[model samples]
Target: MRHRVSGSRLNMPHSQRVALMKNLARELFEHGTIVTTVTKAKELRPFVESIITRAKKATTITQELGTKSTGSPEAMELKSRNLALRREINRNFNDRKLVKKICDEVAVKYLTRNGGYTRIVKLGMRRGDASEMAVLQLVDSEEKKETK
Candidate 1:
């Protein structure tokens, strides 16, 4: 019936789909944006959001704990705490770095705002595959200015 089915399969197997999503996420983090099919963008939104939300929560916890500020006795301790948090969120260094960047640079820039951390702009269709294309980017003025 496919009634309760969630998430698009993109016709790929389970393991391949996970791998594809992970790679796309890594690339998106590294580039601060990416252009892909609209379907992929939709799927990637929640996946990426979960990571950002975790980072945000971690940041909030550190802030509340008064541990991560500069020129403090607990600064080194907070650094270790952040490192552990990063490792928990993403096992690899590249992914960890991306998460940290997203948390410190991207998320902080939008702290005053609510959710909807990303935007997907449709770019018509691809020439060869005729697939729908869209650009997904972080919702921040600095990124907009940098790209423009």
Candidate 2:
């Protein structure tokens, strides 16, 4: 009856599905916006949000530990937390620059926001494939407004 099952298969095998999600997510982060199929956007929302959340947590931890004395136990703990989050994120995002952007800049931008990092806007259908299309973008922040 299709109950309790989660995540769209996206007509691809497990490996391919993971790869697609990774690429979609990376592109979305890099460009701040992307247009893809609606189904894919829905599937990607949670994936991207989780990474942003992780980055946010790491940023908080670093800030809290910054004032504390280095070489202390808390400092070591903060270092480990940052490293773990980076390792987890690096698996999907191969680019070092993008990873840095998320950890250093993006995380700081989202520090006050609890969640809901990405937005989805339906864009009708693709003419070639008739696929329902959507635009997925990072929610705008004050910093972004100034940069434009």
Candidate 3:
């Protein structure tokens, strides 16, 4: 009867699953990479991509708006108008800055890649529960020699 179930449950409850995803996403953003299970890495790919896509779109919008605003004589007319426009642009810039930093510096490191941003190296099995173990990492670091 599990006909329409789309995503792996990983035997976790809904809230915990969401929290885990969020935490993983945050870690990936902060570290530009992570080591996790294959299943988790596969799941995190689309989730992280969506965030990066939104950030790229936001940056595009900011660029377009900045170009439009600065091209008009009205932008130079009144101080208040200029201030308002600057405020709007600044808000957009701030939003895009965080996105750009994460997307450009972190995500772009994997730019040539079409997909498969992560890799999974099987690590045998867990001791307690005997579940399969794997190490999931960002693909860009694949060639970097492991220190230990």
Candidate 4:
């Protein structure tokens, strides 16, 4: 009767699972890339994408909100949206700077694109645990460009 569970439990309790996800996401956002077990990457993919999607929405709203008066209702609405998203993101990320980075820079980069903000590349297995490993990372990176 495990149907429709929607996500891997990773054999962890709810709080540990949430902590693992938050830490993985924070590292991924701060470094723009991370290598972990394939199972974990698969799980983190959608989680990271949702955050990027939120960022994209903020970017779109800000772009469409240009020239509005700061005190105007429209401007206030946009500000509220920004604050709300920030607060939502802050739940996963303890550092305010990382949250700002995602909203201001990372999200803005993917504005033209629809989705697929993160990419996962299989990196073979870990020697000790024999777990299938992979690199889960942001798509747009200067280092990725240089490697190309």
Candidate 5:
């Protein structure tokens, strides 16, 4: 019966599922890594990746334009494009500071790479329910490794 349906419902209603994802994403952004159910981690991977891509795009636009915030028509156009990307991301995330951090810092770190922003590591099973658990984390950028 369930042939082409995409995405797990997680046995939750639509609103709750969205809220759960939002909370998980917020925590993941703040801490860099989170331990969660395997199922949740799988679902969160694509969601987080897409957001990072958008943030990366915004960062890219700003970088390409550099300090040219005004004057030229091209600069204005790029600025608008960057603003639109940020606004789209802001719609999903509640905290402005978090959104800023994503665009300015997190995305910048991954600008050199393409996709594969997150990694999910299996952590065996939870004792209470025996559900499979995993650690979802952002992949470390090469720049950070060189600095350390």
Candidate 6:
């Protein structure tokens, strides 16, 4: 039956689902938060988190190897790995600037921690069709306040 179906389809075809996730992700990265239906937010969480994880991994790879001008085997390998990860991340979003922002800013913000990069807060229901709503946001801002 519905056993291994995985991920909510959200009543959209494959292409629409991909596009919706991409747009939602772009908005989330640009604004640090977004509001959407709870079901959509649930689907968006893992998709967005995976991108963040890739960005973080790429950053870690560069940091680990530093900027050695020498063509050392280890440094070269790490550089290639980092590039591949960046390319993988780049293919998902339409905005190159947004991708850079994610890799440079958002990823670095979460480097000290592991996973759980996003938070979802329930906001009751929409008045129209009575669909449940929620605010999906990055958790780093709260952490920033605490560090100050």
**Which one wins on TM-score?**
5
Candidate 1 lDDT at 57 equals 66
**lDDT tens per residue, model 1, 22-130:** 8887887778899999999999999887777767766765675574467676777676776677676675325556767866776676655567888999999899999
Q: Model 3: per-residue lDDT, tens digit, 1-148?
A: 7899777887899878777877777777667567667677667677766655444444444444565666566434433443444344334334445454654465545544556655567787678887666665555644465643
lDDT of each: 0.77, 0.89, 0.59, 0.87, 0.93, 0.90
Clashes of each: 0, 0, 0, 0, 0, 0
Which predicted model would earn the best lDDT?
A: 5
Model 1 score (lDDT): 0.77
Best-to-worst lDDT order: 5, 6, 2, 4, 1, 3
Ten residues in sequence with the least summed lDDT for candidate 5: 62-71
How many angstroms is residue 42 displaced in model 4 relative to the true structure, after the best TM-score fit? Answer: 0.4
The residue-by-residue lDDT of candidate 5 on 38-98, one tens digit each, is 9999999999999999999999898888967578998999999999999988888867899
lDDT value for model 6: 0.90
Better of 5 and 6 by lDDT: 5
The TM-score that candidate 2 achieves is: 0.92
Rate residue 52 of model 3 by lDDT: 53
lDDT of 3: 0.59
How would you encode candidate 6's per-residue C-alpha lDDT over 1-148 as one tens digit per residue? 7998889889989999999999999899999999999999999999999999999999999788786654898888999998898888889985678778888899998897788999999999899999999999999655668899
State which candidate, 3 or 4, has the greater TM-score.
Answer: 4
Instruction: Encode model 4's per-residue lDDT on 1-148: one tens digit a residue.
Output: 8877899999999999989999999999889999999999999999999998887787777776787877889888998897787778887886789888998999987887788889999999899989999999899845557898
Error of 3 at 46 (Å): 2.2
Q: Give lDDT for model 2.
A: 0.89
Worst 10 residues of 6 by lDDT: 62-71
